[model samples]
Target: MVQEIRWGIVGLGSIAHTFAKDLALVTGGTLTAVASRSLEKAKAFAGEYGVAHTFDTYDALFESKEVDVVYIATPHTSHEALSIRAMENGKHVLCEKPMGVNPDQVARMIAVAEKNKVFLMEALWSRFNPSIRKAKQLVESGEIGSVGFVHADFAFYALNRDPDNRLLNPDLAGGSLLDIGIYPIFLSYLLLGMPKNIQASSHLYKTGVEMQTSMIFDYEGAQAILYSGLNSKSEMKAEISGSEGSIFLSPRWHEAQGYSIEKEGELVDYNLPTKGKGYTYEIEEVHSCLASGKVQSSMWSHRNSVDLARLLYEVRQKSNIIFPFEQQKEGV
Candidate 1:
């Protein structure tokens, strides 16, 4: 039998809760520790997940010998510092998306991980979705016939809540583009690769953050029309059209339970049932890579994380959306 991989969750936030629940259903994985700034939250999370340890501080968890891998679920601004610290403590890291506020921080995290000879990955969970995998397979098999155009959007209304929430707080790197917008941006990179050129526009909130944003990614013969916002809901389905036909991801494409293919005037739909909050697949990938002694996954490597960060940084530049943390870097 394969030895179980012990995992630590650093941050008992909403997303962390989802990950912990999903970890329960995955083989070769167990939630061994949880950490949070608040002792109460950490203790509660540990009890709920039956985790063996709880730490009031992330540093405490990182130093725990029981945790072999640490999942960094903190805000975008804290990802780089926390992940690098975890690596320094000899722990593998799977950090949340937008890995950092910008490319520089991501580069630092990657450098630290490489220096430590530890495994590291950005938790872009959508890449592990079965429906997404099928879409990639269809495109690669020439079923899409030279993909030409792609369209995707992710949006929701979240402006009425606390103004201090992460979405509106520039200090926390808040904005639709970095938050909800990353889903569409990631989908574009997955199917279309990085665009050769780009143009973007945005509507800024009173808090000096982007409320809604749209962009067109231009390739040699293909283009991607993508949009994200915090003002309203969008259809959330994604389509990739080529010379022949297209693939349409079911509604809530990022968390899709199904997908459809339109080819030769025929339509076929597929259902993909997942075991948990859709995190089981990524957790499985982690287990497979660790068992093989691989440092980075071919599916989601350091290069992919860097490329995605650069693309977002460029897009934010075009949209004139700058995070306060970015300004701090410039000052330094």
Candidate 2:
């Protein structure tokens, strides 16, 4: 019989609820605990998910013996500290994207995880999506033949949202770049690796967070054009063009269910549906890594998180987009 991996969730936000529901679908994982600043909120979430433990503080959850691993779904600014705390307490961690607000925090998180000998992975679920895996395989197999350019955009209108909301608050590291833009950037990096150069621009909100951002990643012989924004809605599509053929990831590309390959003017569609809000794939990855006694996922390693954070840092630097906390940290 396989030993169950007991899981703790460090935030009771909507994303955490989604993760909890998906955790139920993983065979060797159990949602043993959840934490929130409010004990009432934690209890409510735990009751909804049948979790046996609840904590009013993140530190309590980290120290709980019921939790073997923690899913850090807190705000971007809190990820580094919470992940390190969990690792220091002998718990593995799967942190949400952006991992940290910047590269330095990511490095610290990685260092602590390494020192503690606990598994740590960024929960970039799209990387584990079946359709994305297929797309990568097709590109690697030369089906796209000498890929030359890729374009992706993720955008949604949040103009009417409250200024204090996380999406609009610089204090929370809110911005399209760190939120939605990371998806497009990830696609570019996965296919092209680090770029030779990065060119970026952004429209900042009155609160100082980026409202919309555009980026161009120049590679040796290829380029990726990416965009993300909160003032408009995009088709949320991604395309890869090559000398021989092209491939298209259907709408909402990041959480894509299918893709198409074009060759000789013929387009063939391949639909690969996901299971359980698509968070299940990453959950299963954590389970597989723990079962293998690994300290980091081979699919999305600690180095990958650092590299991704560095890219985000570069983009923000070029765009003059800095979170309030970062400025405070620098005494700006």
Candidate 3:
């Protein structure tokens, strides 16, 4: 039997709760510890997850011998610092997506992970979803021939959210582009490699954060049209068109539970169920990497995170959307 991989989670946010629940369903791993800024919140999460250890301070959790790996679920701006600290403390890290706000920060985090010889990966859970995996397989198998065009969107209305909420706060790197927009961007990158050209634009909220953003990625013989926003709801569907047929990842494609293939006047639907809110898949990937003595997931490597960050930076530049913290850091 494989030895259990001990897991620690920093930041007891809503996503962390879902992750903890999914961790319970994964084999070869257990949620050993959790931390939050509030001791009460840490204790509550620990109790709910049956975790053995809890800490009010993130550093305390990083220092705990009980945790072999730490999942950093903090906001976008905090990922770099927290991940670096975790690696420096000799803990492997699986940070939530948009690994860093910019390429430089991602490079630093990757450097620290390499220096520490600890595993590090971005938890872009969509990459591991069963439906998405199957879609990749079908595409690779030529069931869709050569992909030529892709269209995807992720959006939701958040106008009523308080101005200080992380989704709207510039200091926290709040913006549709970094938050939900990333999903569509990631899908494009996953299907089509780095684009030859990227054209993007955005509508900024009064707080100076992006409310809606659209992007067009030009490849050698293909193009990807993508959009994300916090101004209105969208169908949240994605389509990959090829010479032979097309594949559709169902609504909310990021966490897609099913997909369809269309060809020759026929449509085939596939239902790929997920375990425990769909986070177990990524957790299992981490366990596999650690068990194999690998420092990064081949599927979602440090380089991929860096490349994604760079792409996001380019998109922001084209859109003229800048995070307030970035401005402050640069003394702009």
Worst 10 residues of 1 by lDDT: 321-330
Q: Rank the candidates by lDDT, best first.
A: 2, 3, 1
Clash counts per candidate, in order, are 0, 0, 0
Q: What is the TM-score of each candidate against the true structure?
A: 0.98, 0.99, 0.98
Backbone clash pairs for candidate 1 read none
lDDT value, residue 135 of candidate 3: 83
Select the stronger candidate by TM-score from 2 and 3.
2
Instruction: Provide the overall lDDT of each model, using Cα atoms, as 2-decimal numbers.
Output: 0.90, 0.92, 0.92
Candidate 3 per-residue C-alpha lDDT over 198-315 given as tens digits, one digit per residue, 9 for 90 to 100:
9998999998789999899999999999999999999988999999999999988889989999999799998988887999999999999998999999999888898899899999
In angstroms, the error of model 2 at 268 is 0.5
List candidate 1 segments past 4 Å from native: none
**Candidate 1 lDDT, 1-332, residue by residue in tens:** 76799999997889999998898899888999999999998988888889889999999999999999999999988999999999999999999998887888899999998899999999999999999888988898898799999999999899997889998888888889888888888988998788999889999999999999899999989999999999999999999999999999998999889898898999999898767879888999999989899889999999999998998899889977777767766799
